[model samples]
Target: MEKKNALTAFAALSQPTRLDVFRLLVQVGEAGMSAGEIAAALDVRQNTLSANLSVLLHAGLVRNLREGRSIRYFADTEGLRGLLGYLLRDCCGGRPEICDPLIEDIACHARPTPLDKIGQYPTPEDHT
Candidate 1:
């Protein structure tokens, strides 16, 4: 992602409601949720949720799909990966030990699944 886009994403997540919504979506994963579902989950008003969702969509943090009368929103993993990669691209001047712990933390934060069950996440030993 471009530096400007990353800044926009960070700014969008800075708000309480938007941050909650984004985290909620991330937790929900690819199954996603409709506007109504998201509103009910967060106890946010439709109008307010719409505005926040719009900002997330613009920042490329969230994506929506039209499903009949409803729109299902998903966490834009690609965009998020790009943002994370940009931040960690040059970690501790290429020292894995300094960066491995941080990477582990990020992986944990990105998914709700157990590390053992989620084989996709790399263990510290994998990098060593």
Candidate 2:
């Protein structure tokens, strides 16, 4: 991502509601969720959620797909990865150990999984 794009993404994520929406979309994976479903899950009003979603969409953090009558919003993982990489690219300029643990953790969790595989999520049933 370009520096300007990273700045835009960071600015979009700076808002509380937008941050929650973005994180929720990330958790939802590539399948994503509809506007109504997201609003219900977050207990946010329709117009409010719509505005926040727009900002995130503009920031390139989320993408919307028209699925029949409903639009599904999914996280732009590539853009997010780029932003994270850009931020950490200059880390540990001299002392490699400064970021070794983080690199190890990322490597440990880097095993790829097919998007169709739905891991355990805290569904409504799980809440109770």
Candidate 3:
């Protein structure tokens, strides 16, 4: 992420409500959650939640899509990953060992099982 992008994301996360909303979206994943659902889940007023969502949206941390009478919000994972990468790009300098454990944890947590596959599988030959 560029410095400006990182600043924007950081600014958005600086707010308590926006942070809560962003964390909620992250938990929801790609399918996301509707605005009403978010408000209800957080016990936040609709107007307050709306303002928070707007900040996250402006920061490119969340995206909104019209879903019937409601608007659904999803975490912009690419933007988030970019921000995280930018923060960690030079971490631990050349040693790498410090960040290696974090990288391993991320990989372990993100590893997909058969049930997590979103599409069809390929043969072993396709790995090459």
Candidate 4:
């Protein structure tokens, strides 16, 4: 990601509601959630959530799909990867080991399941 794009994403996440929305979307993975569902989950008003969602969309941190009358929102994984890559581009100078643990902690270890092919970590229920 370019510097400006990263800055926008950071700024969007700096807000409490937007941050909560993004984290919640990430947790839900590809299944995504409708606006109503998101509003209910976050206890945010529909109008307020709409504004926050728009900010996240503009920052490339979140995406939405039109599902008939409602819109379903999801974390934009590609955008997220770009932002993460930009941050780690010069990670730990020349000491690769310094960033190893952090990388390991964030990286997924499980194979992708049919229901979640985007490298989201499998939930325990997935094994059932």
Candidate 5:
């Protein structure tokens, strides 16, 4: 992402509501949530949520699709990747080993596990 675009995204997330909205959408993954659902989950008024969603949309951190009369929102993964890439473009000043652990941590979350296919997470028993 360009510097300006990153700044806009950062500014959008600087707000508590927008940050929460983005995190919720990311958690849901491809199965996005409608505006009503988001409002209810966050316990935010529709009007207030609408404004925050708009800000996130403009900042390229979130995207929405029309679903009948309602709109379903999702985290824009490409935009997120761009911002993350920008941040790590010069990571560790060319000493990759220093950034290896951090990169691994982020990459681990990027990949979906078997439990994701069933829309569930592994329990302690599953791990054993």
Candidate 6:
């Protein structure tokens, strides 16, 4: 991704509500949630959720599809992947080992497992 696009993605994620919404959408995958569902899940008011969704949509970090009379929101994986690639393109001085754990963390988060009190997540070492 270009610098401007990366900045936009980062800005969109900087907010707490937007971040939560994005993470939730990512977890749900292509089976996205409607605005009402997201609002209920996040315990947020409709107005607040609408504003957050609008910002995310403008940043290209989120996309929506019409489901009858409702719209379902989803994470824009292409945009997110581009942003992630841009961030890690020059990370850790070209050492893949240094980035392995980080990738594992992301993979862990992508699944729908409950986190423990210690916030321990499955790592590459866990399966070894």
Best by lDDT: 4
The per-model lDDT (C-alpha) reads: 0.81, 0.80, 0.80, 0.85, 0.82, 0.82
lDDT of 6 by residue, 1-128 (tens): 49988998899999999999999998887778898999999999999998999888878788887667677888888888898889889999988899999888767444355654544221211110
| lDDT for model 5 | 0.82
- Once model 1 is optimally superposed onto the true structure by TM-score, how far is the C-alpha of residue 11 displaced, in angstroms? 0.2
Give the runs in model 2 whose Cα sits over 4 Å from its true position. Answer: 105-128
Q: Output the lDDT of residue 57, model 4.
A: 90
- Residue 53's lDDT within candidate 2 is 86
Candidate 2 has what TM-score? 0.77
What are the models' TM-scores?
0.81, 0.77, 0.80, 0.83, 0.82, 0.77
Q: Which tens-of-lDDT digit does each residue in 14-39 have in candidate 4?
A: 99999999999998888888889999
Best prediction by TM-score? 4
Task: State the RMSD for candidate 2.
Answer: 7.8
Summarize candidate 5's per-residue lDDT along 20-121 as a digit string, tens digits: 999999889878888999999999999999989888887888878776778888888888998888878988989999999887876645544745556532
Which candidate do you rate higher for lDDT, 4 or 6? 4
Model 5, residue 122: C-alpha shift (Å) = 26
Q: What digit string (tens of lDDT, one per residue) describes model 1 on residues 5-121?
A: 989999999999999999998887767889999999999999999999999988988888777778788888887898888777787987799988876776655445555553332
Q: Regarding TM-score, does 3 or 4 come out ahead?
A: 4
Candidate 6 regions with alpha-carbon error over 4 angstroms? 108-128
lDDT of 3 at 109: 67
Residue 96 C-alpha lDDT in model 2: 79
Give me the displacement of residue 106 in model 1, in angstroms. Answer: 3.2
Considering TM-score, where higher is better, how would the candidates rank from best to worst?
4, 5, 1, 3, 2, 6
Listed per candidate, the RMSD to the true structure in angstroms reads 8.7, 7.8, 8.2, 7.4, 9.1, 10.4
